[model samples]
Target chain A: MVRFIDGDTRVLVQGITGTQGSFHTRLMLDYGSRVVAGVTPGRGGMVVEGVPVFDTVAGAQDRHEIDASILFIPARFVLDPALEAIDAGLDPVVVITEGVPVRDTMEIVANARLRGTTIIGPNCPGIIKPGEVKMGIMPEQVFRRGNVGIVSRSGTLFYEIASHISRRGLGQSICVGLGGDPVVGLDFIDVLRWFEADDETEAVALIGEIGGDAEERAAGFIAGGGFTKPVAAYIAGRTAVPGKSMGHAGAIVQGDAGTAIGKIEALRDAGVAVGDLPGDVAEALGGLLKG
Target chain B: MKLLEHQAKKIFLDYGIRIPRGELVDSAIKAREVANGLGAVAIKAQLPVGGRGKAGGIQFADSSDDAEMVARGLLGTEIRGVEVKRLLVEEKLDFSDELYLGVVVDRRSRSYMVLASREGGVDIEEVASTTPERIVRHAVDPVFGLRDYHCRRVAGLLGYSGKEMFSLASVIERLYRVAWEMDAELTEINPLALTPEGFVALDARLNIDDNALFRHPDIVEALRLGGSSDLSPREREARDLGLTYVELDGDIGIVGNGAGLTMATLDTVALHGGRPANFLDLGGGASAEMIEAGVSFVMGDSRVKAVFVNILGGITRCDDIARGLVMARSRMGTEKPLVVRLVGTNEEEGRRLLESQGIPTLETMEEAADRVVSFMGGV
Candidate 1:
């Protein structure tokens, strides 16, 4: 009962000839993601790690069924391939590229909304279903099969927290990285809706950082009774200075908004266990799941 | 990158938006020369950040002598830590009323939101915090763009009617076009003065998206931003090296693979009573060379007593980080005592390489931060 993806979900590998693309495609395949086809313009006949490459997503779609597409293209060249994938009717297209121009992402997002397609990220690690399908670049060993649905804005923080969860004998049903950018396609509410509907997911761990009101809005949703699952969270950048982008472009405090303190309070007021440190997230989730 | 006042006015003029008759001058002599041409002028310091008007950065001059005096005082003076190198001399307008107009990308709507207000000539944030309902907003869809109806609605809310409504609507239309064409994150006119002729932008702020600058080659050539002067020399060098770094007032320099993790590392270090010297994210998919460069850069900071490198390798391989650690140690040596935390994705090979180089490694971020603080002799 994975929320977004599972073993049967066929994956499409965009930029299959590129170094990072080829490497991650093989890893995803090895993790049993069922990567059926690859697409890289003008490299149709190429075979990357036993995955047949096509000239375009349409060409690959014609030959083999592709449920979702994972992009490993560079930032500058990513917009076209992403639009092509979305136009080709691929749902939940994951853009693993970092540093994509915001305007280009706007165009992609608008197009996706028009097509009713779900785009995961432009600067994020993709999604993963533990012990079934790994559609992202997250290390496989840190995750174990269980019923906890994890979603985060930061990739490494999620990894740090997920490892702690794994160590505490808690496993995950699915983990999703919504990306750390000023604007992203998927929001916390979108993932939470799916998590609430997922019977296998008994609990959720949300990893949020400073910048943006996603966490606050997610808390609002929870407080409004949109989700009933036991939830815990860790908000980073508690001591971040105002008007400074801390690593991620989206992780900045502007005026009085998007502060870690504000987010923690919002989550806590909504009856969500909020943690102070990375390890505290695992502990909070452990406590919530037990309760 | 935030465009200075003169730059924003230049872009606004390009979009056919009405602006005060002005010229940007570097010296007092030039300012006087411009003021002589346009009597009763306003001398404003050209800066990227806001809050200048209250900080004495903006002053009125009735005569050319007063203009020169004000310009002399403003030039080479630091406003908000930034030295004002230029001044914009403009003909002061006698307006009956002032209004506000702005466009910013709204995160919730995932679209550009055009904000208009009847109350102007003051801080918009203050008005937003205080009066709240004084501000009117219209979300502009990128596909349909800013339509005539949206502008009219905003103008009507601002107490405009009939001819005045359409007149103000055109300015909003032009500003919205400027925002879209420039790939601007924020475009603002704090006081859209309603003069006898029409509305004129007394001040303008256009913050373009840095990532979208590649598409606007003309702006890149004309602006020549050359990175921000606000960045420290070390920070500028870090930017040049493609590492995201933020300088801090601490002795423990910190580095990590991702932004969220790096910030968390900073918090954790501070929690352990260690003041972090800087924030350096190597980015996801960081190579061995990048790691070496980032490590060398952080260690180069003379004020930094110790360095903490926390890499929870996922896509960023631990072996690559270890190799970089080995290279950095061989090249720069261990001038700053460093703590390395490596995990996941070839963790063994990475740990072995770092350990063989005699650089001790920790397992968790807590251990890494704690060890580095201890290296500061229990600071």
Candidate 2:
């Protein structure tokens, strides 16, 4: 199997009756993902696109073997379902819902950690393994099967960089959007570790943005030889400033870290090749893998 | 959203935390009346940003007349580019020590941290840079919260002893309660003055998490009562329209489908020798109508020489963007040049649509950036 999932991986869709949920559910099934069951509280007895819907994660699990779960619930009601999936022993709880409260996210993260399960996003496009398991909202045509492993903070960046590499005749083995929220389940470090151990991934392309020490910490991990694979990086928001609304605490919390320039310098210091723009990623990643 | 100093102090008063006796006033008459009762006061301009003390936003007045004069001088004056319409008139505290106390979310620990230091009333970042050892850090468990032992440990690190130590611990506990209950991203009491009376939060800074506003109806009400005075008219409109638009001093206006891509578009525009007038993200799967609104909003800016629409359409369809581009051009009635870069979903169909409409749609961000920058020289 690819690092996270494969075509045969049994999937569970939370909030399967909703518009976006039903649409992506059909998309995943069409892409050969084994989306066996779905959960939609009151709409349990109904069938969506031939997939049986259950009221609870436990009820869905009782009928079918579920490997992973994707959340498409409303922001106000997302936490309970996310926690239910985690409690039901789902390995990767992919939350596609946006606007989840930071407090709820903190609780979910803490719970996931306690269970030793992986929770991908509170506001993110989920993961995809190209032609294999498209357990995400990303379109399938631009991506093909290849060697580069992609991990990004932003969804569109993931698409742009991956499509750039694919157009250059190289494709991704796995591309993970780690969400655009404050705290996420997996960071650059965790994904890099996965890529280092993944035999399919020859090189890695990383996309970062302003407003966190995630990149700096990833740099530290790479410098310490935590992940031996070649990495090509791009930090968005080079001309970006800390959001004025974010206040002094964000700056005080991170004294000299989290700046785009700071992250670039750190990545450079760690010997990772940093791209100047989105299009430079595929070219730099090609160079990195070759040399 | 960040709370003004007076709002934060009001919350502090609601909790058991001690704060300087103060009231928020917009007029100099009210400031004089408050100062008359308090005798000596600190007329602090209630701005959303920090570093106001050094910027002369905080003024000292020994008498009510001086307070009125200081209030008149501070009101309507801009501090760090934000006009101050209100002031926090408070009784100045006489203190022996000015210690730093703050609670903030620590992404590294995946928990909240209580930061304490003997050094305060200055830049905490400067303190962190110059003498990081002076700052004591304690990670609080989200479930258990800030425990008694944890607070006591912090108080001891700040050089407190016996009853004062316990009192300081209680203060920290109360502050933690405020942070946890209020869904605060940051809670700070810089210069938590250890007066002969007790530990008074001389300056209160509170930033509530924007996402958690759904839970705090009280805070939502407070926010409604206190309009978003910090945002400009355009920015306020952008907020209502669900677009993330940040104004910049440049000639090119950028519109994109996501935050990261939008930011990269800005950087790419700058890299190709283009200056971006603003950062506008239309978000994922933005409809043709939303794009029209976004582009129209940016074109409304007289300083913009050209507009660049960058769409990497994983979920966002390029045809929708192309349709929106034509709509924006027709609706705005502006002659500003446009650059469109489309990739991912429905790329070719959208490009064909734009080409047929006489809008040149480029395939790469680099080429689009180059073309947009060239327009800045003329057209």
Candidate 3:
């Protein structure tokens, strides 16, 4: 039983006429996601991959019972689509578009919080519940239905780490890409709390990079007895030097607060099984599960 | 997007924050003339990073002739890998009190934090570490912004009183406004000095968000002007194509999936004595066309003796990247050394596609970097 999404969840595609949205919508439907409708604004009355299209998210909701939405809108128009989806009463919205301005993301995040809607990312790869629904760009073949919940900041890193777990015959209950942007909606602790409460998730894998104190904060939460399930973690950019800003503007370690070594040390001290290499992540989790 | 002191001061001036009179001059002769005209002047190297004074990027010239000599020596010299093309000649101020003020986006709290301190002209990090009470911080609401009351509260924390308190508070307000209006990620005044004349922003460093450039055409144009002209032709081409590329001191030029991977690749190269010639992110979901452009850009750099293609395909399909690589190689037609590490969906297909075309494929990112550095003769 994957968390956040399953066979019961009805999905709608925003910007369904776009190449990526159409392709992924078809993929999601084939993977057993109950994709009910698509929204293309002005391209209404059309059909994409057997899903009916409408002008707005409200129109799409009127036509189909869209419990959740996966947005594929361009970066500039991401905020509008997300707000529209939330306004239309979509429970959870997965935003796959990257490069949305931080200001726009802040507004979207604030609005989503106000409306009690879950907005995943404006720069993320979206989420996937193996064997039930794949709402993101993750390789479906690599993920299997299992009890390990995964959350990551980097999309590609998530897939690679998930592949490592999949090779060990241990699949994920649900994998969420929180996006690498500084102003992304959900934090590591937010996703961790969910995984902690989910009965399906016996353990969790957290993929973090150098930047922000999110990992350190998550470690504090775990150390404070906020989480009972064992967490296997891997922090990237360990060998990276300080004062060099990474690609994500938010990932810059200006002072001593944000560093890979600092984060790894904090997590290690917090009783997390930290993996030194990508392939070793599964082994770390296996050890934790055994314990 | 780090703005030099003079450029940052210009933004500060626009926001009604007072700054010492300054003029940017490129030649030593001009520097001498400006210094002489200003009477008592501070000669500062126009660089993007901090610790300029400690790095010898800043000097106080007693006479116009001395200013000229220093300016000539600085221009065309490299400071922290960035060439000093110009010098800012500013009138030095006699300060009654010195303070520190800055507005930086606190990523942890997801808020714009205003940092103020009565003790100025020193590194804020050092201040935070030693006497943490000296640094007073207040998170500004993005919606309401930095109000007068909020500034006063911060000023009170810094132990300011009377006119000095009022003046410092106003400066904080103005700085916060500039930071918000300009979409700046960081706006710092190292020494917000309280002179006999008034409160002045003695040193300024502003870093604007690169993503918000479209809305700020003026700032964008100003940044372009301040930018170095020593950029490679391919780098210029890539910039014109709207890709973010920054050259480093690395021989293994990397073009990758995202900014994070590009930087990680740089770190890997640096660990192996290979300086990455540039940080080029083809962006997520790069097509064959973009890859061709990226390859051309990387190969265009003479310093880049080798190229590393590190891709983690998710939404960006490995096959699509392979097609781009094949297209880029054929189009460029230069057998410049290449190392490719493609992982994720359709990785095997991507490997086969590249191998069929005789391009070398590595199993891991570390191996690819090492191989490229080795190919460059231990660069």
Candidate 4:
């Protein structure tokens, strides 16, 4: 089975009447995701892309047991819908909206954790299991169903790497973008643990950039025997100047703590093959797979 | 979105937290007048970045003459890469104790955590590494918020008792409120001084969250005003067009979609022997208008000798990027060498659009880097 979602995963679309929500809901349905219901405050009793719209998640959950929920609401209104989905017992709630405030994210994370719910990104390209389910905003042509597990903190870069892997005759089991915000759901360590447990994922490729200690923490976990699969890694922003926020709130170089060199060193020390550039990652992973 | 010291202190005053009386002055003569009224004062440089005291940006003076001399020494001078355009002259305080207090989003816990330490007047990071036990931390539940009991527990850890305990607790509570209401990533009052009168926030620092700025229009307007004065010409142009741009000390201008990819482009350009002059992210699903703005913004930078447009289209289509480049080149009439790397959705069409215009495009990041660096004389 896939880690978060697969062919059998019944979905409820949060903010489904909105532009992005409706558009992606149609895409997910086309990709064979079992989208059972949609939720919009005042748009209930309406049909969006052949899915029934309900007033709230509770109303949607009343008719069907939703395995997951994808949020496409505006940033300010995302927190309430996220909490409502968590309380309603959705396993892996995916938030596709960007610009979620840190405090709101903190509350959502805390409440979701207390209830054993998994939240994936407030600003991210969501999960994609190629040929099975496409639950996020990523373009589908780049992915091919296969054995490689891809996890990244970037939206376009994830697509870039995936296209390279697909071109190299390698395909993905499941790819997840953990978002670019300072605080996000499902970090590298969490995704790595899930990839380790999934039998379908033969190898893992982590696309981390300069930011925070996420890559370092993931290195620690891999070095400590937390994951047994062969891992390939690529880190961006080696030449980024310190004290500048490089678009992403989390992709800032604060002194030397979150620099690309430090992250590369940590991953190298963990016996993981580190690509000097994103182009090199696929070749490095191919070598690892053969060895 | 880091606020200057005086601005943070103003926010503190709004929360009923006592701050040392201060006046912001743009000239040394004005600083002298403010200092003369206060008797004894500190002339601190108004910059958003920290470590000003260590950088000699902060000076204490006993008289108006000394204050003017100190302000003259700091005004219009560069400190830690920032020019000292303004000085915050404030009345010095007499204190019996100096305590450290801060509220930050603890990434490890995924919660807002308050840090308290009896040892103050030094770097908190240094204190944490040297003496971990001296720093007390309490993770607050975001839903429940910073309760009085939580503040009391923090006060107890700092060894406060009775009236001082209540005073410090309430001050911490108010600081948390300021942090919460302001949507600050970090709210710190280093050396929350204990005078004979009460606990006063001697030094204040507030780093507001940029994402949450929509909830606070007042802060956004203030920051916009501050931006116009503080931002460089290229920066001001980029901000006007909603592009993420940061100037760097290099020669090659780099632009890409998404933060990670933009940074990667910079690194790739550097790897191939070219230094990046700036980092500009066109952002996800960026329109042709946004790309036009980004290209012209980079072209405006005098330091940039060459440009690299890196686009890995996911939600952002490659055709839009190509059309934007073609339009920008025709409209702006710039002859700067631009190396384009377009991949993913509609890439072939995008490349054709550029190739038809005599603008050669590369297929890979490595090829784009090699080409761009070659255009810049290989260094």
* Residue B117's lDDT in candidate 2: 91
* Superposition error at A17 for model 3 (Å): 3.0
DockQ of candidate 1, scored on C-alphas against the true complex (2 decimals): 0.77
Could you list the chain B TM-scores for each candidate? 0.97, 0.95, 0.79, 0.90
Native contact fraction, candidates in order: 0.74, 0.59, 0.28, 0.76
lDDT of 4 by residue, B1-379 (tens): 7888888899999999999988999998998999989999988998876788999988899999999999999999998788889899999999999999999877777877899998888999888888999999988888677899889989988898899889999998999999888999999999889988899888998988878888989877876666414456677777777889988889888889988888888888888888899999988888888898889888777888888999988778889999999988887675789889998778899999999999988889889989889978645
Worst 10 residues of 1 chain A by lDDT: A1-10
Interface C-alpha RMSD per candidate, 1 decimal: 1.1, 3.0, 3.1, 1.2
**Candidate 1 structure quality by residue, lDDT tens digits, B1-379:** 7778888888898888899998999999999999999999999998767789989999999999999999998999999988888889999999998998999888888888899998889989889999989999998777677899889888998889998999999999999998888888889998999999999999999888877888878777766652334567787888889889999899998989899899999999989989999999998778899999999888888889888999998889899999888888778877779898889889998888878878878889998888899989656
Enumerate residue pairs that collide in model 4.
none
Candidate 1, A65-142: lDDT as tens digits: 889899999888888999999899988899988778777788788888888898898788889999999878998899
**Isolated chain A: TM-score per model?**
0.97, 0.94, 0.96, 0.97
lDDT of 1 at A209: 94
Candidate 3 at B297: error in angstroms? 5.7
Task: Please provide TM-scores, in order, for all candidate models, with all chains considered together.
Answer: 0.97, 0.95, 0.87, 0.94
Lowest lDDT 10-mer window, candidate 4 chain B? B223-232
Provide the global lDDT of candidate 2 against the true structure: 0.85
By lDDT rank, best first, the candidates go 1, 4, 2, 3
Ranking of predictions according to TM-score: 1, 2, 4, 3
Identify the superior model by lDDT, candidate 3 or candidate 4. 4
lDDT of 3 by residue, B174-215 (tens): 998888777777889989888888899889988777777777
Clashing pairs in 3: B250-B275, B250-B276, B251-B275
